[model samples]
Target: MNPIATKYIKLNTAIPGPRAQELLTRKEASVPRGPFTTAPTFVVKADGALLTDIDGNTFIDFAGAIGTMNAGHCPPQVVEALKQQVDQYIHTCFHVMMYEPYVQLAEKLNEITPGNHAKKTFFLNSGAEAVENAIKIARKYTGRKAVISFERGYHGRTLLAMSLTSKIKPYKYQFGPFAPEVYKMSYPYYYRTPEGMGPEQMDEYILQRFQDFFLGDVAPDDVAAVILEPVQGEGGFVVPSKRFVQGVKQICEQHGILLIADEVQTGFGRTGKMFAMEHFDVVPDLVVMSKSIAAGLPISAVTGRAEIMDSPNPGEIGGTYGGSPLGCVAALEVIKMMEEQNLPARGQQIGERTMQAFARFQHRFPQVGDIRGLGAMCALEIVKDKESKEPDKELTAQIVHACNRRGLVILSAGLYSNVIRILAPLVITDEQLEEGLAVLEGVLEELCL
Candidate 1:
């Protein structure tokens, strides 16, 4: 193999070297195939934007644990907080004994989440749980059973979340008897807007369809909430126009249906804002947060208007591990770190740099069909050809694998799985970011050109 000359990446052996191969063998034998993993090796250590594998190979991490590490891997403040909290006490079971950190974090969320309205916040264990609870609260408050989600949107994997999610192959295939009263609506995909429709026209068209939908399908009065991802994470990083988002909010307002923003993957400075909803100048009645909220901690939260959140009385919601002390402490430190370090502004810089590179790639490669993003949350759609715009799923997979082999960990997104997405940690330095991008550009040149 050609010698690698770099500062961050150190590939002393081929991927899955002896030690990793041994682990991989054991993993295949012991673990189920259902849980998918992008890289085929086990990590020994991770910091900032780099990961070291068990086999002594180091790589630049561009996936950021699927957007869970916006504060970077094991951020010093979060790690230190976790260390201190672990020694003090672990789980007091927020329900049984309660903890100060839980309430503190909730207050912080309520203060920071969009709007000046009086709001309340509660914690959960995962993004899916937050979504489920948000829907539950909306239903209870509105006395409605129907919920509306958009096409190509992804919520999570649990029963109700899976039912609302748009993907089928890995997430929902054969997961029968999905939750009842969940409806799907059309979200604008500007790139794929039908033949002659402009983005504005498409936005209006989709918004108008809601009227017909209320008439033909579930009535607006029966809808409890309309859940949206300001920038669709798993749906190929598709971003909606301000008009579309506001239009949806307006419709929800007219029908007295609550609007829920699912910020699972887009929260915590991923999209140049603390929450993606801020980009549209729309304030959702309810918000679901997780992923980067606690820098990989298994904690999620639902923050909403006070009256709506109070709909679920005592003993109606919450779980044993929700808002564990460790998660709360770590999240507190994460929020402080984000504010002190100004990561949201950093996210904007990353987005600018990445989009510039993507623009260059589009000019050079015929397979580059479209480049789109909202902030640091960016993606490049791979296609058979620019004109046809047929999703090149196979090529997309090949590009991801090639970049991985070259020691740049990346990921693919989109309903068709034909888009390369960048979720690199906000803490990544300019040199590290450029090197990782170089690796990706090289792979694209080799595979797509």
Candidate 2:
């Protein structure tokens, strides 16, 4: 039996209860307030699929640290492994003094990261670092200056990552002089298409938008790579169709541009497939990965064909705390847990159930303009007008707040901030999922009314 499931959260009162507020107050005094949160509430302890705040109020956790805990919080096996590693040692810098766990993780990633060819992995501290290294590798390997990322594709927050990321409000608002030469392209988001086109035609139009806005202007060969998210997380769970991915891959291949799948958010079995790229059958030259790779530790990786990953010379990429033995051990255990739990297949099942519930929601709520997903990663992009597909940002916020009030943690995303991204831990129980979904239904009914 699966051992990573949550027991239950006893809801004594509203979320962020009281003790959470105390911690929040403490945090405000101790830490900078900028990177804090737009989302309300605070957490104290999380185990499996449930979170108990400091005030003793328990809430069902659906955010799952932005989909970083695929195996659930403090899974016994992973926790045990971490404890054992803490006893042995913590940090020795994997690059300075080699560790078996790091090597073991690399070996596992090389074998599992969506390709049969000879592959390699470079570990880092976060998704941004992984993405930065990927861009560096692509540029070095191809000897090019320009990179092509998609609209609404979020890479990370570093200068280069922000440059690669497309949203501007807060992520790139004041951060200027972003790494120059990085360009944006069109991704296949079916909901917000320019009116009067079928799905296929819209996809082609976006493809043309790429070649026209990019290749028509800049020399394709000069572009080093095109980074993408298979099922965009923060940009709304926009699952680009198989054909759309194939079309983009063809364009990149034709232009001698390497495809960089930024599976940082969608990889590590969040999608039904191990890697989201597997759904499209397109093998990227470089795949940037992170998030749940180490269960919850701050570790990420860029895994790809040997040639590209090998382009960086010694001392070209690494960090002081990147891929510590603890993180590496956590990653190894995560992979083992996923395989044992058959998380990829389980993701499909969860997606099916979640989608069915969303279908019922759509039937009842006119605001639910679109419901899309790949696996446990699913979402509903609220719209003011069904035909116009205008973003109902206000309504989306209300829905989110309502969900939080009801003791179910939910998250919001999208370019216009109108999409609710549902990224629960894979270990959440059917009972807990149903409870959360019911709360979601109440929120939808309450807000959409």
Candidate 3:
């Protein structure tokens, strides 16, 4: 039998204990295998940073729904707002009849997101939809068809977004032909830089390639935009230097191309800032946001310069369920909660504590190859050895599964699938944070040592 009592974790049975096993059987019978799951069991309830499974086992949530719960699960304010909205109305599509909440959210986003310049905001239902629309607006405004995205940056699974994405296997394999005129560029990976290349040199090298790329591959004037994830999320929590980000912005400016910051995974205090682009002091012409925008509600937004956003005619860009009433109300409440609670500052504190723990793990384990992140969006890359630095994809998978079995919910990512990333909620208590990290450390000792 598994342990019955712990401070936060309570395991009354084995991981997929009886109840969860029954659900898993039913799930396998009905659901396709295409959608992957990190944790094996099914949840009965979830709160701030913990999840209680159907089998009565409780686990610390380090994944935070892939960085979607920055304000935490079921935040009271957001929930209350949602309930109030449901009582009033659920869906009165913005296209058919406009609502107060939709306009209110737009005002809040325009004021808080990175710039003081005149901006306009519009809503969609998912990150991919926002990216797709951002591209449409950019192309319509600039009259150019080419788009560039960084290597290992993930936008979403939609055709155009997927074509812009760099991962080839599970995300794009055999699902072609891909959209045309999408290009890939190098993003600075300091830890994995070629032997003897200093960090500054690596940044300069990649920036220089942009010039060469324009000359040899596509003319800059023909490019609509360059979309980037301020800090690469699905490509592992790879954080680029401020210099690198600003350099990319400068190139976009010189070339008359729009800069699109895909903040789907890094926005709403996931990275110790309201928006990750603020960290680099680069104001993107177009910003794509989702994930934590409404505390896991299926809503996305594209905020851009007024002139650029205005290029699209009224009927050309909206969907039937574009901005649901519930989503807008929840998002407005979420933004209010974030400001009142100062969640971004709290995220920075969590990040510092986690990074310190990772540093200690590196001292004790040879397999802990590299640790990198921005704010609370932290990740550790696992390798075969420090010297060789060969990605240990198998070991990474084992560690992740083992952690899950032991009442800690963690996930792995990276181009090589060898990175263990933590996306715990910004509202997670210090005690919950420490307990989760302790479980991770214990697993590392058992697996790596």
Model 3 spans with C-alpha error above 4 angstroms: 1-5
Weakest ten-residue segment in model 1 by summed lDDT: 1-10
Cα TM-score per model = 0.99, 0.95, 0.98
Clashes of 2: 0
Instruction: Encode model 2's per-residue lDDT on 1-449: one tens digit a residue.
Output: 11122335466765666766777788889989678464456666788888776677777888888989878888888999999999999998977788898888888999998779999887899999999989999999999989988889999999999998989986889889899988888887777666787789988888778767664667887899989888788888888888889888998988889999999888877888788899889888888888888778899998889988889899988889988898999999999989999888877887889999998987788889889898888898899967778898998888888777667788899999999888788888899888888778877766776
Write candidate 1's Cα lDDT for 26-89 as tens digits. 9999999998989888999999999999988999999999999999998988998999999999
TM-score between candidate 3 and the true structure: 0.98
Clashing pairs in 1: none
Tens-place lDDT per residue, model 3, 48-123, is 8989999899999999999899989999888898888888888978887889988999998999998899999999
The order by descending lDDT is 1, 3, 2
Task: Give me the candidate number with maximum lDDT.
Answer: 1
Model 3's number of clashes is: 0
**Runs with alpha carbons beyond 4 Å of true place in candidate 1:** 1-4
Comparing 2 with 3 on lDDT, the higher-scoring candidate is 3
